[model samples]
Target: MTSFNTIIIQNIVESLNVGLMVISHEGKIIFLNKAAGAILDLDCEQHLGFGWGELFITDEKSNAQFNQVILDVISQQKVGLKHIASYTLKDSTCPKKLSITSSYLTEDDATLGMVFLFEDITEIFNAEEREKKILSRNAALQKERIEGLDSLSQAVAHQVLNPVTVIGGMANIISRKLPEGDPLIHDVQVISEEALKLEGLVAAVHSYCDIPKPIPVVVSAKALFEEANKSANEILDRIGECIEMKLDCTVDKITVGKKLFHTAIVELLLNASNFTMEKITDVSVKVSRSENIITIKIADHGMGIEKHLLPHVLDPFFSTKAKGVGMGLSRVKKIVFEHQGTLQIESPGSGKGTTVTIELPCPDLSCCSKKNSD
Candidate 1:
């Protein structure tokens, strides 16, 4: 071919979206297109004239299989079409899926080299994997919800109510009969406290089961924070503990269930108050929009959770505190989920502080308008 034609062909190959590579029968890489360099995560300019094995070989055994496929195509002098291979880069810990195609470069019955074409299919593979996981998770959640309802019902009926009532009544009668300063008075008080604890547990269970469906409305973000602040402050005042909650929100307005959102914030505030008894707590709130999602982040510089305990923090009845019923965060998560939002809790180890984030979709206003009209 003429030099100009060769240059034109090279430019065309370079401009192609799919990765292209040419290796001589001697196992030397003669040409590496830009796309190929990017997909394989290599410097194309330096790799020319280098052995193909130098780039493809890795500690990961998957590369060996990939190399074997290339060898098979060359030995059989056949086209390898749509060969899906797993490739692990030298510096990356994750393996990537690549769709590869190979064909021999021949001239008049003489095979000179081979051309390999490939593209990174990692994102496509990952998306399918994610869908599978979500489907499996939905099935598990369905089973869990049924079992949980049955268990909660049995406990409330047969185990908790009757026993708690008898223990509390007997403890009160015994306390009334005991004289002042009697040592038995302390024992009676202990029984009363235990009974109260059980009663509180029952109330928590009822609250968890009774969360109503949210009615979403577009409301001012500032107004929601103000209302939650007022309610939280009142509870703080009754308890005689003064903790300051400072909020910095950039959001103007959002579409959410007003009452449910308030509950979620207050629950977080109360939980934060537990750690900030000795120090002032800073509650940082920020709202930002990305694509069709709006994210609200609430962060506090209080005693954060430990790494190992973070995973179970959302589990119902799981508590890190001695007297905690562990339903507070659970209720908050339920409220967020019902609103079609996701709740995430992250901490920078113990004592470093924690951040809880809520992400909700930014609904098209026209849809809301149509709903209102109907």
Candidate 2:
């Protein structure tokens, strides 16, 4: 009756879904389920009499791992061991991943041997590896493209500057020589404006290359904005009282490049002022600071950027205006990141207005001093 019951139990175990193998008290391979035979290319009857050490062959890298697990089982290191191994079988075209769980084949707390359950996870690993390679390839391509753009911009900037200066100089000469209200005076003024726009484009490109060289200093956010506001108003008065200031920061001083950082804020303000050309537009500059980050938000109630174009706003030389240089936001983004900060641009649809938020880390004294000296 006992032998009959044992055979019935073994048959029941062999019919399960997972690959199951049982080792006897002498560490011999006593039983293997049907799933185990299929997974391991096992001739169940031939392999039943061998020890645990004579199981399926793992790859060269996993051979020592297999031995270590066996040693751990023999020494009763813990209640069980679970490991995943990939191995090639006799008739296999590719490696198969097996998630194996080995536990003591015990009854009433007595030492029996080990039982292992394995699952084939070959497809899962292959999918993960494919996704990883795709991401790596994309990152490599992006990096290569950026480096190419940087090189090309540098070469073009020098050539652009000389011609722009000459045109600007000629425009000044023509405007001075022409009489007041002359029809050609307006044309010469347009040429001056266009030349200035070109010069600004060159400067924006140069700012990208020079962002790394800023010597950080302790600067007052209040004073910075005050100066920036005055400068922006002077250069951008045509847009009316479009720029309004709101400061809500208790911490006044932040560490950054006074000149370049001021330049960054001025760029954002100018961008807002330029786009709000219709009537007297409202452009607001708000500053808020927290324990860790300082945020400067610039908002404009003007012609907002299009949704499709918004995503590429910070990209170098990206523009929507017929005569836009496309370096304003790009240079602003570069400067904000150099200060260990982030710049976020948000706009609803076209003609709804745009908001740009810049968040910067609050500077620590020792670190600020170190960076300034360096």
Candidate 3:
């Protein structure tokens, strides 16, 4: 009956999908199933007494982590389980992800060493990594295409505007020479005005194409905020009944591209001015620094953005305003990304206010100081 029981146990162990190995208390392999021997690329008869660690190749880091697992299970005299761990083989070119479990082998009276069960997850990990690479590549390609389209649009605007400028100039000269109250004079003046409007449209397109250029200059945050407010004050004055400006900044020198920062801030202010419903009474700009990041938050007390539409606000040519071409926020996002920063927008649904936050990596002061000294 004992021999029959042994045969049944062996058959059950051999039928398991997982590879199984039993090691003796002295770190010698006492028994390994056929699947275990095949997975480890070993001959069961030849490696019966070999140490498991000596037969497999593992990096120092992975080896230490694996040894800790064994020690923990033995210390508690409990079953141990771990998943998605790499195991290196001497002849295999790549590491394999293995789910491993260790438990004590107990007889009627005494406890032997541990038995280890392993499942290979190499294919699973490889498939996940491949998916990630494909997604990353697709995102990069999309960004490149957007950039190329922006450049082409800018070039077309520039080419069309030069000839338009010449025609507008010639019309103005011809209009001045015409007699007062002449119908032709009025017609020429109207043509010049329309041409100028077209020029403004072309200029807007060029602004959308203007990618941020890297300009590492030291400038105080307070001073930059003041400059941006001063630049936008004239426009705010023109829309006096609809918009208000408030600035609150406290940080010192930060390294950034001045023109790009100014452009982004101005765009935000204009966008706020265009959307406010409750007289646009408060457009606030606040700047603060924490750790290694500089954060700028712009909030507007206006008709808040719709939750459904908020996500698309930064996409090119997606705008809620009547006159907006939808490139302003997209340009803001691109500039922020080029500066190795992030831009985030928040709104408490429709009828509430909207807030946009920009965070950029702060320059290392020590490195800047060393460069200046040199």
The best candidate by lDDT is: 1
Model 1 lDDT on a 0 to 1 scale: 0.83
Q: Which candidate achieves the best TM-score against the true structure?
A: 1
lDDT of each: 0.83, 0.78, 0.78
Over 1-374, each residue of candidate 1 has an lDDT whose tens digit, in order, gives 57998999989999998999999989999998999998887788998998988777754574876787787787777866558888877778888898899998888998899999988999999999999999779957955894587477556745787889899999999999999999999999999999999888888877777787889898988889878877877887777764465666665678888988899889988788776645445677777666567788888888899999999999888998999999899989888877777899999999988999999877865554544475
**Model 2: worst 10 consecutive residues (lDDT sum):** 56-65
lDDT of model 2, residue 85: 72
Worst 10 residues of 1 by lDDT: 365-374
Per-prediction RMSD in angstroms?
Answer: 12.9, 9.3, 9.4
RMSD of 1: 12.9
Relative to the unseen true structure, what is the C-alpha lDDT of residue 214 in candidate 2, on a scale of 0 to 100? Answer: 66
Considering lDDT, where higher is better, how would the candidates rank from best to worst? 1, 3, 2
Clashing pairs in 3: none
**What does candidate 3's lDDT look like per residue over 1-374, in tens digits?**
57988999989988877888888878788998887876666787899999866655355655455566565666777766554566666655677777787888888858888888878777888998999999789768867886788878888998999998998999999999998888899889888988887787777678777675668788878878777766766676775644466778766677788888877888788777677765445788888777667789999877889989988998877877655567789888878876878899999987788999999887786654554475
